[model samples]
Target chain A: MSALGSIVPLAFGALRRNRMRSSLTSLGVIIGVGALIVTVSSGEGSKAVLQAQLATLGTNLLIILPGSSTSGGARGGPGSGKPLTHADLLDLVAGVSAARYSAPVDRTTTQVVIDNQNWLTTVYGSTPEFFAIRDWTLARGRFFTSGEADSGAKVCLLGQTVATQLFGNGDPLGQVVRVKIMPCEVVGVLGGKGQSSQGQDQDDLVVMPWVTFKSRMMSQDRVHVGSILISALSPDEVSHAQSQAMGVLRQAHRLSDKELDDFTVRNLADLAATQEQAADTQTGMLRNVAAVSLLVGGIGIMNIMLVSVTERTREIGIRLAIGASENRVLLQFLVEAIVLSAAGGLVGIALGLGGSLALSAINHWPFIVSPGWVLMAFGLSMGIGVVFGFYPARKAARMNPIDALRFE
Target chain B: MSGEPLIDLKAVTRTYLTGAATVHALINVTLTIAPGELVAIMGPSGSGKSTLLNVLGCLDQPTSGSYRFEGREVATLTRAERAALRLSAFGFVFQGFQLIARTDALDNVELPLVYADVPGPERRTRAMDALARVGLVGREHHTPAQLSGGQQQRVAIARALVNRPRLILADEPTGALDTRTSIEVLGLLQSLNHGGITVVVVTHEPDIALYASRRLVVRDGRVISDDRQRAHDAAADLQALPQKAA
Candidate 1:
């Protein structure tokens, strides 16, 4: 231990004698480590942002859209087939054991007016179960009741955008708003949900009872819904719920074994997984590039250490003649290399953190600092020092004291 | 003189393979150095004087023969063991005054003790004392470039003395200094010898060899003559030289 203690100062003194060369040699490590930190932390930040956006859609959510229509060998795209009905939603909830909540939805776009202020927005007609499936809660007042939905009462709930557009900062609940020519009373105001994964504003719509919407707003068939939204009991049950819903719908439609599904069920969990995988691939590529740069940096260290060994041959001879052992000489050079690379690693970490903070602020992403990655980067730099330093140290240690002292 | 000889070499031979040519650096040379004796090995270039000094210092092993230092067989020791023996028992001074560049005198003197694993405070005290013994008390902080050639040689001598080794081996210790400075350095070595440290000096100049009590002349890798003579007083010689004009 005392030998190591003495070796450290000797190493430092040698490095200090050639400050410029030492700094330049470690520059490669600095850039490599800095780039690694920036790429990894920013990758994590983007991934977090994407996950939060996905979460805003709902928990264990699934969307079932109507399949394509076929006529005279001509096929229309999805949502052009025989529309799904409220009965199909009811059958799915009853048949699928994993199904937690389900809602039948019909949508239309129209202008809404409160007094003299008018704003164009999308309107959704759904039951009270829609709020549960979407994981939505009211900011004020209460959601419309099932009685109002079944009785086809002209009551509505306002999304934050719609409320802001028509009422400004005024109380929106209990106020009356006109959808086209029909007036409806606002029962509640939904809490804000920001932009979604597809960059669409989720808070730019109004929701009302399905009975009132089919009768008064949209001109579609009264019994058929545009789509069905379902939530599974847990994240792991989403695929099971989807398969169960498909079976239930196929049986309800009386389709034969040879027939294709009349509706398409999409598991949002799968979509999330695919997006997360893409993020991981991007992060992995950047990490590999950073690793290559670090390798180049290690090579640079080795090159400088070799040159330093040659330059200090006479010094080695003097030390050896004064009773320094071969291991002592080897330790001295190895310590110098380690100190150089480790110091570079520290500076790189600081630079990378600063770069990540700046990028997050500029791009409006959450700042995520992964301590494990930082430690690994530091360990990698130190390992490079040891691996690259050994050959030169060994060369110096094996020198003949007579020849070395005579080295011109 | 009653104890075993400090160094014993019996028919030692060292050869070099220089690109398929066998060069005999030392050929069947047998010699012994008693404790506290000042000996000089004199020869022209390529006569194996340096090689003999290297063998005695344990920096090189004989190609074939027994080399015993303080009654211990040096030929059987490993490279690391030889290094440890040198560290504990030998000090070396070179022709170029091989002090590490850019380091102060005190640090150069402290070099050997650093490998000895001496603690910091004690190493400093001993280094300072060694420097003061060489009459370099106020020049402890001067680097090799900052000090004169004579001062640099003194720093090298101080480094050799700092380890308190039993033997000091100097190969042309005054090769780079002037006449008066050479006498000063020889005076220091003679005083060290008087203080019971064995000294072996390798030089081609007969004047330099006159400072030692005994001399061995070498020719063609063989010792031709060995003689015991009264050594000149380096202090008296330094006093007799005329002072330089300021």
Candidate 2:
């Protein structure tokens, strides 16, 4: 027979003779590889979920929030300052060339009651342009007209959660609901938007005209708007739109270059970039952890191979005495170790795929099956076998034939 | 020696150092065996008969000596070269049979040819032929564990002869067998010797030494007595036993 072909059988025979021990040694590799696949796949899946969540935040959209407020020598948080103004919104929309649409927003947390069914939700104050800027679509009825928004009409749209909680499959259109003691006609029901990246429910709010919100509900002043939502001309122009809007607001607020503006410009693109970077960092750490576990598994293979070499000292001697070269004996043991780890790698891949499937199912994330990761993990296991098995194989090959033959 | 010696050792000395003490395993021993000779080396536990066999078979190197095999100075050969020489020219049989366990008899016999890099078909055919010569033709598929001690030794002998080496070095080939099994194993070796292969056996038993054409008694790491005799043919002895199974 060919030299390798013959040696392979001898290695397999030795392993078969110690079946339980060989399997136990391979078990470490299986767990390592399985965990690696699960970690990477789940990481990829979560990243996809994050992207999906970001997409819902609206494409190429920028949000302007009051930067920070200082009261009594104490600086408040970013959104707690100056509360963006209506004139600031008008100047930004007119001055920023890349700005496609802009809308002022104000919100209040209150209970809405209809036919004794009351639900707590955020009542948002915005214009018809708010729906366009936020990319919000109606599942039923229609959004308020610009005239209704300008004329301080008592018309509102219910988010999916509010609609479900107040209407319960009943038609919400034309129904008047008491939103904090002010009865308003439900003009539309917002489509379900699922959850945001921050794990907040995005569809638990009510929308109404900013004029009506100021007149009937809460109004701090005629000049102050809680926030402003602006859409860019396209996703590619988002950064340009952000800088243009920032410069326009700075000029309108009459803040000098040396002074910090009392407003913050937040873009969906920026949030997505930061979230993606964070996910990549987490995925990298997880990959390192998996690699370490695989390393430990390789050490296990090395340990067992050393033990096998010691246990089969006499067999090695016999082979050596029978004219097998030192390299032949070394190759035999090395092949045995590789076979063990490769087999374990295969099993681990199957287990890892199963784990990813479980994770995707439980988390409701996309099932991401990356073939590259599987091949890499399998290749790594094989490499582990070679790297860890070498020392023991060399020891076996370098054994003195006479001493080995004489060994009990 | 009547003809050119197949193995010639000149002033062969093998020494071992253990914890600051020197033990001369084989001390300045010169020995030669010509073609087609059956020689037995007899020695007590530490007389170094096995060491001499190891040096003769090219399994080991002499500490300070010249070992010539087939007129080639083998003492200067590298480890790989000595292994190649052993593969092409000599076969070894140990007391433990040393047939890889869990392997069939045919595969055990094919081990040497594997190192020789023979093609699969020819290795199997030659291994079968060697097994047939050892009279274990029908037991080719039986593992060493399934075979009796005599059968296992026969498999080992088949393995030794599969390469068709010019010399056979057997160290206590029958040491682990019963009297009848030992006789059968010796009979197989004697028949191979009769087929014109040079055979060297190392053993302490006088009864086992009776099958050799020449006997060398080793004492204190040196050959004290060398005697030539008409060898008792083990095959003939086996035939004389009425209950002979092989």
Candidate 3:
């Protein structure tokens, strides 16, 4: 057989010579790569799931809130100091070039009594357009018209939790719920929403006409005003929409050049943009961590090869003293190191792909399976073999025949 | 001597640099061995006879002077060039047998061709031929660890002859064998010599040396004696040596 053929048998021979050591070395690589596979795939899948949820916050949606009154109480960064408000929303609707829709939301917390049961819920009051903007669909009955909202109509909608708590499985679309000394007829029941960021069952909240909420229920003069929710005709117009909304709010708040406005605009696009940036950062870190694991695998390869060199010193001497060239000996050992790491890489790739698949299947999450990354990882493994395995191979090649023959 | 000058060493020197000092292993040795010759190198433990054989086998380079193999100056050859020179020109049977412990007899014999890049079928055929020549045709699959010491040395000799090299350098080939095996090993070397392959066997025993047509004695890194006999037959020499000694 050719000298190269000997490499195949010799590599196996070395492994057979010390099966335990070889197994232990490979075990390290397997563990490192396995953990890396799970972590990377998990991180990628989680990011995808979060992005998908964020996308449900439609591009045409905007929220108007009681601009947090921190004008003199501003304690954070410049733009973050402002809160979104209703006047800002009105002005933005009248002024923003990109804003195609806007909504002003007002709400209160009240204890409602029905029969012997008492339930506390948020009462959101807004124009009927709020449904289209917030992407909320009514499960029964109907939302009040804009004129009814302006005229302070006595109509209400029950959130999912309040409906279940009060009505059980019965229909309550036309029933009346007493909202703390005010009786408003239920006009609609909102589809069940799991929960909100503030730990309120979004299903449990009630809704009413904004004018009625302001004129009949709320006694505050300015009414919680600052938060503005806006939606552009398309997702891409968010930047222009943001600037236009800012200009109108600035004009209404009458901000001077030295003064940063006391209001902000938050839209679906903004939330999506920040989330995408975060995803990018997380994905990059995951890749870096995986790279480190592969590097550790590389070190394991080099370390085992060196041990093989020491163990096979006499064999190397015998070959050299016979007729083998130094290069041939070196090549034999080099090929051995590369084959080991490459094999390990192949196994790691399969495991990594399978791990990604399992995660996607069980969690219903999205993952990017880039063949480029797999190929890069495999190539890196081989590179590790060549770069790290060189020193040991050379030492084996350079050994003195007489000394090696006498080695115990 | 057949007047062939198969290997010629002129003013050769080999030096070893240990951690603290330069050690001269061989000093200014000049010698020539003719074709079909059986020569033995004899020396005490520290006499450098092994080092001399190493250089002659082309496993080592001399620090000074010239070594010519088949009239090609060895000192002038590159590492690969010397590998080529060693492949077709010299065979080594190390003192330890150095039979690549895990490899079988046939595989051990095929090592040279492996370097020569010979194809698989040819390598197997040639290796088997060498094993049969060494009377181990049926035992080609036995590893060195499985075989007796004499058999291991015989495998080593088969390895040496597999490439059909011109000169065989055996360094204490029978050192570990029993007396009977040693005699058998020496007889094998004699038979190989009779087949016209030059052989150089290194040992410390006079009996092993007596098997050769010529004996060179070395002391303290220098050759002290060169003795040649008209005919070499261990059976005849054992009988004749007593009279010569008296």
- The model with the greatest TM-score is 1
Candidate 2 docking band: medium
- Each candidate's DockQ: 0.83, 0.74, 0.59
TM-score, chain B only, every model? 0.98, 0.96, 0.91
Model 2 chain B: lowest-lDDT 10 consecutive positions: B237-246
- By TM-score, the better pick of 1 and 2 is 1
Model 3: per-residue Cα lDDT at residue A187:
86
Best by lDDT: 1
TM-score of chain A of 3: 0.82
User: DockQ of candidate 1?
Assistant: 0.83
TM-score for the second chain in candidate 3? 0.91
Ranking the candidates on lDDT from highest down gives: 1, 2, 3
lDDT of each residue in A212-320, candidate 3, tens digit only = 7777667744445424467777877877777777677677777887985565456665666687777778767777777777778778878889888888889988988
Q: Which one is best on DockQ?
A: 1
Query: Per-residue lDDT of A69-166 in model 1, one digit per residue for the tens?
Result: 99999999877897888888779888989999888888889999988999999999999989998878888989999999989899999999999999
- Regions more than 4 Å wrong, model 3: A1-5, A60-88, A111-119, A137-204, A215-226, A267-297, A347-368, B1-4, B19-22, B230-246
* Candidate rank order under DockQ: 1, 2, 3
Model 1 CA lDDT for position A210: 92
